[model samples]
Target: MTLAAGSLCLGGIVLFVVLAAGALLAFDEPGTANDGATFDAYVWRVARFTLLQASLSTALSIIFAIPVTRALARQLSFPGRVWVLRLMALPLGLPALVAALGLIGIWGRQGVLNSGLAWLGLAQPVSIYGLSGILIAHVFFNMPLAARLMLGGLERIPGEYWLVGTNLGMRPWSIFRFIEWPAICGLLPGIAGLIFMLCATSFTLVLTLGGGPAASTIEVAIYQALRFDFDPPRAIALSMLQITVTAVLLISIRMLTPKADEGHGSGRMVRRFDGRRGLGRAGDGLVIAIAVVFLVLPLASVVSSGLRSDLTKLVTDPLVQRAFLTSLVIAVVSGLFCVVATAAMIQARQTALASRHPTKPLRGLASGISASTSLVLLVPPVVLGAGWFLLLRPFGDVALFAPLLVILINMLMAMPFVYRVLEPAIATHSARTGRLAASLGLGGWNRLRFIDWPGLRKPFMMALSFACALSLGDLGAVALFGSQDMVTLPWLLYSRMGSYRSTDAAGLALFLGLICLMLTIAGTPAADRNDKRKPDAA
Candidate 1:
């Protein structure tokens, strides 16, 4: 029964993608021209720009992260070290639109940077727009993630290696070359690929900061084709191009980066001699300080600018009220859907794993069901939205079904995350209690309430809250489907930015950021605590 349900959920995702792709293909030929630009030429330009930015963003993020990760790994006992690591996780939950606004407040024409430059009598002020701005925003969001992941790789290093290196009187560079470099290198391919995929499919950051056509990504181009130009053929072409690029990236990531065993280390600190004094210590401290400032300044700008806005008036506006409610409803509904689907998949996989004589096909089925959830990540939200737009347009007004499509896409997008959060808890619960529950003749709700729920409640809530936060901040699907009647907070915030309502946008950004932060805090405590308890072997 659980397998059937999981299969149904997977089937739904497949059906949606198939219908959308079929609709896109049915509507237009590939080489058709739109707005005097041949579809082929336009696609080539957009695809090239997309890959270029993604590659650059990945390179910059990884390059910046190496030093930060190394610094954190070396300086384990520094003041507020735990909080600094926690700070690195904050950007993951921060909405792209909110982060974009924060970046603008710091880097825009009348921003702090320009003001400072003027005070310093500098002739030229930096512009946070176009390729430069996209790279900055991507790096801001991705660098910390890379650092944290790389730090995990560093932490996984055994204590004996460090001991041997120290006994050999290895210099910093020598230790890095023989020890730290290999650990970091093993992680780089996977981290870089993940960052590249994110930047390639990035929609909100590019839409907000991509300046013009000269810097547009394929995802943004799809939005423009549908929303601005009303060119379905062009949107279809771009969507296909986006999918192709994503598939290639996914294939490359899989081929280049073999999976590593999940590490479970004893929680014990390993003493290290490197970077304990002299210029090495100072250099590590400097790197950490700069990273902290780079991260904190944008958030500070958001809060300061937001508090200065007319919040009472903005909150009172009916449009704002409606959008807020709409966003909450969508987020909650999507999160619930994700929870149900993820639970089914987890149950099926665990049941298969617990089988006494599992067949090859059964094992394959379980693996496939588990992998299917992540399949959504390969399809950009805009592509899904565009395909659905084509699929629904002929029936009636697409806007009428916008809310449903948005909810579905957001749910699918959140499923992988929800699954990751809930799977371990559920598996551990089953391992500990499954036999006892079976012997007691417990089944269904009785077993769940008596055994599973007690242990799984926190994890379940964490998954739900994280899923909700993700959906709440999503701008990609809504950008394609949003209308006067179907407005979401992200869509509303983007509209405000477009209209030059910086004060209102700032206020909205603050509200969204705070809500996301709360959800993230609730959802991440377990993982944060777990990380804090990790064995540091630097």
Candidate 2:
């Protein structure tokens, strides 16, 4: 049963791509390619912009993250520090539309900064549109992630390193050169590669702030081809291009990133002797403060601006109500599907490993199942949506299948994250209990209920909540399928923003942020509970 379920999940992804490719092959006109129209210009322009923006975004995010991570590394015990670290996770799950709105609240034409400049008679010198806007939004979302990953690497360094550095009377730069820099250097390729992949495939932020053709990425171009231009050939070509580019990047990342078997450090807290002098502490403070303001101010502005909105009107608004319901149903269904599918895949792998006959074939099948869960990462949502859209257009009304497509797409999209969270726990559990289960003659439902469920419940719940939050915040497929009848919150928020309903958008942004936050928070205590239990077990 587990193997069957896992096969179905893997088959679903393959089916979508196969159907999409079939649609393109069936529908694409040979003459269109020979005619040399938008395809040529779009290929060069969109590809160029996509690479340029993703590269710049990755570089900027990592550059800004280094100083902040260093600062936080040095000043580990400041008041409210832990909360600030928690807040850093916010941008990861925060809806793109919410972040975009929050950004606009502070950086828009008549935003706080502009108004302040006007008061100073200093003609507002900033514009949060075009390439600049895309970069800012990308940085807002990615810098914290980069910082945390780097900080984790820094913290993993042994305390003896700090002692030796101080014994040598090494300056801050010298210490970093010998110790911190080497650690960060090893991590940079992976971190930067992940950031680049994210930015390269970015859809919502680029669409919202792209402003015009000058800043459009390939993902946005694909959307425009299908939605606005209604050109299937162009859309298919762009989708293919996007997939190719993503595949190349994924391959490159696999090659570039170092394996994670470097060092298992002595698990003890390091006493910091460097970066504690007056000027060094002051510098660290400034860096930390800047990072805080950069990360926090936009969120604060969203809340402050949202407060002025009338809640009664927002709740009563027909579009908001419909979109909220649609979003809730999608999130809930997708969350459940993601968790079950992931469990099935993990179970199948465990069963294969336990197989007494034809172990090689069973293990190979299990490996394939494991790989399929991550297959979603290689295909951008826009491309997947476009592929399915092209496939369905011939059958009839695409709107009828919008909800179903969104749910399936969201499920596949969340699988990687879900797998990452659950795989470890499941592996550890199997290692600990596989023999015991076999000796007891436990298998299938009985084994799962008697062993796996109790052991894996916490991580499963946490992964589910997180997957739900991710799906809740997604705008990819909804953007492709949005219409009068089918509306999700991110789509609705985008609509309001596009229609110049700033106040309404801000109010909706607040609501969306709250819901996503609650989903995230619901899972937090589970992690804490699991952590507390770990020490006792150890």
Candidate 3:
């Protein structure tokens, strides 16, 4: 029964993709063929820009991350280290638009930096627009992610290795070469690939700061073709191209990354034996200071700027209230859907594993089901939303289904993360409880309540909360469906930004940030306590 339910959930995902892609192919206008000259040129331009920005963003994120990771790894017991780690998690839940605006608040032409420069009698040193702005935002988010991942790798290094380096009197650089570099090197390719894919598919950052055509990415191009041009054929073509690019990147990431569970660990607190010299400490301090400012100041701007906004006015506005309600409904519904689907998957895999004599076919089926959840990563939300729009257009009003469609997309989007969060916990619980349940002839609800519920409750709730937060902050699918009647919080916040209501946008950003932050906090206790995790990453 559990296997059947899980199979149905997997089938639902497959069915939606098939329907979306088939609809696009079916309804694509033949007229686009004659305009091939213009279309091809446009496609090539955006494609090149996407690759260029993604590659550069990936390189810069990893380059800066190495020093930051080195600093954090060696300086483990600082006064505010735990808070810095917490702040690193902020970007995961922070809406992209919020991050973008916060960045602008500090780095824009009339922003804090420029005002400070004016006071200091100096020229403005930088512009946060076009390619430079996009790069800055990408690095701001991804560098922390890379640093955390690398720091995890560094922490996992055995104490004996560091002790040996210390006894040999190895310098920081030499110790890094012999001890840290290998671990970092092993993770870098996967890190770079993930960052590259993120930048290539970035929509909110590109949409807000892309300045002009020269900076547009494939995602923004898809949005334009769908919303601005109303060109189904071009949109379909762009989506296909986007999928192709993402598929290649996903495959490359798989190949480059170590097959073992290489990330998302609550790393053990370990002592380091090196990098204690005054010069070394100074270098580490400098890198740590720069990274903190780069990441924290934008967020600080969000809080400070948001505090100045009339919160009562922004929150009480009818449109803002309606959008908030809509976003809440969608997030709750999507979170429920993801949790149910993920539970089904866990049950099915556990069933397979607990069988007395596991067969080849059963093993293959379980593996395939697990892999299917992650397949959503290859289809960016922009491409998926655009494809679905093409599917629904022939049926009359797509806006009528906008909320429902967004809910479904959000479920799919959150599945991979949900699986990542829950899988290890579920596996550990099942292994510990399986024999007892079987001995008592317990099954289904009895087994779940008596055996699984107590052990798995924290991770389950954590996964649900984070999944909801992810849905709350999403802009990609919502961008495709947003209308006056269909406004979500993200969509509403974006509308405010578009209309030059920066104060209102900041307020909305703060409200949205608080909601997501609460959800993330609700989940953290469980994650922190689950140190016995065995990686079952999807």
Candidate 4:
């Protein structure tokens, strides 16, 4: 039964992608024949810009992250170090639109940076729009992520390496060369690839900050083709191009990066002898301080600026109220669907593994199911929305099913994350309790209720909260499907920003940020708990 349910969910994802691709292909035939040259030029321009920005963004992020990660690894016991690590996680979960707004508060024409420059007697104020703004935002979002991943790699380095280096009286540079560089190298390809994929497929950040066509990415171009130009054929062409690019990148990343073993550590900090004083300590301190300010300032701006806005009026406004309600409902439904689907998949995989002599096909099926969940990432939300937009247009008004489509797409988007969060907890629970429950004749719902819920509750809630937060902040599908009746908070915030209603947008960004922040904070404890269980599991 579990396998059947899991297969059904996996099949739904496959059908969704196939139908979207089919619709895109079918729609392109007539239009491509006539506008092939125009389409080709336009796609080339967008694709070129997309790769350029993604490459630059990826480069900048990794470059900055190396120094920061090295600093973090060297300065292990600084004041507020724990809080600094926590701050890094903020950008990962923060909404793109909110982060963009916070950045504008710091870098816009009349923003803090410009004011500071003017005070310093500079005549020209720097612009935070176009390519510059996009790169900044991508770095703001991805740099910390790269640093964290690298830090994990650094942390996994055994203490003996550092001890050996200390015994030889190696300088800081030698320590980095012999001890840290090798660990970082192993992770760099995978980390770089992930950041590049994120930047290449970035939708909300690009759409929000991309000032004009010159700076626009393929994802933003796809949005413009559909919404601004009313050109479904162009949208189809762009969608296909993005799908091709994404699939190729995924393949390249897989081929370049070997899968590493998931080894559990003793959770003990490696005491390092280098960077204890003088220039090294000072440099690490400076790097950590800059990183903290860069990340925290925008979030601080969100809160301060938001509080200065007409909060009472914004909250009481009918449209704002409705958008919030709509966002809430959609987020809740999507989260529930994601958790349920992930649970089914996990159950099926566990059942397959539990088999004493599982057939090769059975093992393949289990692996395939896991891969399929992640395959959703290959098809960006905008591509899915565009394909579905074309598929449903013939039937009638697509706006009627906008909420349904958004929920489904968001659920699929959040499934891989939910799977990661819950799979471990569920597996651990089953391993510990399976035999006892079976011996006592427990099965089905009763077994799950009696044996699973107690241990699984925290992880389950964590996954649900994370899924909901992701759905709530999503702007891609809703940007395509949103109409008069189906306004979500992200769509509303984007509209306000476009309309130059900066005050209102600030207020909305604040509210959205707070909610996502709360949900993220709520989910962290479960993740910590899960991490603690890892050593035991190993």
Candidate 5:
């Protein structure tokens, strides 16, 4: 059953990419006998420019991340350190539209930076429009993520490794090179590929900051063709090109993903002075300060702007009320759906693997199931929305199914993160309990309740909470399929921001941030909670 579900998921993903691309590719006349001559030079030029910019953006973002990660590893728990690490997660949850708005609020002509410069009697110089602005925002968003990923790798190096280093008199740089780097090197390719993929597909930031046609990404170009020109062929062509790139990069990501190491264990990593006392402390301080300023200041701008807005609007706006209702229903329903699916997956694994599986077929099935769990990352929001829409349109009213659709897509979106969070505890529980249960003639719920659940309660609750938070902040499929009646808070905020209602957008951003922060806190416990985490990651 698990194998079959895995196959279905893979088939669904492949068909969506292929059909979407093929439909768009067919817009061209294949028999233009002068085929080479018939190729549009303008499209070729745009595609080239798109690839070039994405490549540059990815390179710069990852490069800056090194210093940011270095600082975070040592200084995650200073006065405001926990807040800084928490702030880093905002961009991942940020809707592209809101992020663009925040970017403009600080860097646009009338923005804080310009206004502040004028106050300083300096030239109002350096435009936040075009290539430079997009690059900076991408770095702003990505550096923290890279740092966290790298920091996770460093932390897994058992405290014993640090002790051994201290005994051997290994210097800070030497310790990093010999012990830390080797462990983290495995994650670099995967992190870079993930960041590159995100940059390549970025639509809102590129559209908002790229100034004009000269700096747009392929993703924004696709949106323009579909929304502005009503040109299905061009949209399809662009989709095909994206599929080619995404497919390649995602395959590489899969090849490189580490073995499951949940624990959401990356909360506020202020492991002070694992290296040297004075030098390490200074280095950690500098890194933490830079990260906090970049990640938190824009957020402060949002909140400060929110304070200036008419607070009554949140209650008085009928649309806001309706969207709030829509979002709540969607979040609860989606969280339940994800919980059920995860439960099903865990149960299926237990059933099949209870016996010491030496059979090749069973082993292959388990591997495929694990890989299927990873598919959520490969399926982009728009692609999943488009596929399910086509598959279901003939039979039902998609508008009526808006919330359900949102829940379903969100389940997919939340998979890898959910799996990453739950897998470690699940693996430990399965390892310790399965053998004992089999020997004791324990089976079914009896074993689960008596042995497993007690051990896994923390990780399970943690997974559900984070998964819910993920669904709540999601803007992917919701943007494409959600009607005015089915609007989520993020989608509604995007609409307001899109229409230049910055004050309202800011207020909503602050509200949404609190809600998400609350959920994250409720769901995932910090590394301190799970002290026995096996200090090994693939």
Candidate 6:
């Protein structure tokens, strides 16, 4: 049953790819998979803007995150410190539309800051549109994500290092240079790569804020081609280009970040050691405070508005009702598919491994490599969606599959995260019991019964709940296919925002946020209730 579901899920994604290929092949008869030549202007201009914005966004976010992470790294004894860390984490999980809304609330023309500026007799506040708005939203959502991930790295060095550095008479600058940097270096590639990927693939953020032609990214361009123009040929060509760009960057990212992404999920062991005293602390504190203000305040405002907004009318709309149902069905199906696909892929790797070597050491190495393939970790959501969409749409009306297709795309999109959660537990079980199971001559169903099921109860369940949470909040693939009759919760919220129905949008955002939060919280009980507490998957 599990394997069957897994096959169905992966099969659906494959089907989508095939459809895209068929579509492209049919549409572009003799045409190249380049939106170039005829649209030389769009090709160069979009590429230029995409690269420029991504490079600037990544650099600026990381730079600004440094001081913020430094201050937040100080273990606070006060109330709400933990909440502050969670606020940072929340952005990682926030649907893009939610973050975009928060940004607009503060930076929009009638926003608090702008309104205050006008009262102060300023000529005019700067526009929160085009490059400026995109940059602000990107930084607002991503900077904290980078900072928190980095903060976890800073806290992982053994406390003894601090004492040792002090004993060796190392000054704070020397301590940071010699001790902290080394400990955190292993994590930087992963964090930086992940951030770069997220920035590169930004979709809803760009769409919601890309005020004009000048600010459009590849994602927005693809959306325009399909949604506005319904030009399959141009969309397919654009998709191919986007994939090429993403794949090239990802190769570099992989070379830079092959290590497993693990530390951030675990609790940190924080310490007190400012690299400098006095003004340094103030500067660091200011950065951290700014991070909190930027990340948290927006969500708080969203929750407040999301709650206060009159929801009765929108919630009752047939379109909203149908979208909600479609989203729920898709999320459940995708989550189940993720669970099975993860299991099958893991099993395939193991099947290859066990047949090759019976030795524990060799098996360990193979398992490690196979597990790391889950490093689908580095592929961002939009990139994957674009690649598969380009590769599949030619054969059929992708709109026929629509929302369910979105769910399948999202599962493939989420494979890396689910695999990370399942890898270690699978490895441990194989290490301890593989030989014994072989000796018993266990086969197929029996193998899963005797070897896999017993050991995976907690982690598997945890993985499921999380997979559900991810699918529930997913916005990218759906962004491609979702329409008036086929929207998900995120798309519905986005539609509301575009129509300038702020109150309805807020209510929908609150609804979506609650659904995500509940599923995430439920995952804990599913994992923890087990008597077995396996180590976290890397």
Task: State which candidate, 1 or 5, has the greater TM-score.
Answer: 1
True lDDT of residue 473, candidate 5: 71
| Per-residue lDDT of candidate 4, residues 20-53 (tens digit) | 8788888854544455654677789889999999
Candidate 3 lDDT over 184-269, as tens digits, reads 99888888888898899899999998888889998899899889888777787788888889999988988888754443434543
RMSD of each: 2.8, 2.7, 3.7, 2.9, 5.6, 5.3
Model 1 compared with the native: what TM-score?
0.95
- Per-residue lDDT of model 2, residues 300-369, tens digit only: 9889878888878999988789899999999999999989888878877877777566477787878888
Query: Which consecutive 10 residues in model 5 have the weakest lDDT in total?
Result: 262-271
Clashing pairs in 1: none
Cα-based lDDT for every prediction:
0.88, 0.85, 0.84, 0.88, 0.68, 0.70
- Candidate 4 Cα lDDT to native: 0.88
lDDT of 1: 0.88
Tens digits of per-residue lDDT for model 5, 310-421 = 7687868888778777777777777766665665565555445656754766566556557656555554655555545544555787677667768877776776777776
Better of 5 and 6 by TM-score: 6
lDDT (Cα, tens digit) per residue for candidate 6, span 1-538? 4334434444554455555445454555454444455356786688788888888888788888766776766534434666677677777666777777777778888776788899999968867788888888888877887787777777666666666666788866787688656656676777776677677777878888888778888777877776677665566666666766777777777798756433332333434555446876666667767777777667786788887987787678887788778778888888888777777667655654656446765465445545434333333454445545555566686677676567766776666777888877787888998889889998678888867788887788778878887787777778877766677888888878889889888888888877777777666543345556322211
Query: Clash pairs of candidate 4?
Result: none
How well does candidate 4 match the true structure, expressed as C-alpha RMSD? 2.9
TM agreement with the true structure for every prediction: 0.95, 0.94, 0.93, 0.95, 0.79, 0.83
Residue runs of model 2 more than 4 Å from their true location after superposition:
29-38, 261-268, 355-360, 526-538
Cα-based lDDT at residue 135, candidate 2:
94
> How close to the true structure is residue 265 of candidate 1, measured as C-alpha lDDT?
41
Show model 6 residue runs off by greater than 4 Å: 1-26, 29-36, 76-79, 258-285, 355-398, 432-455, 525-538
User: What is the Cα-based lDDT of residue 393 in candidate 1?
Assistant: 76
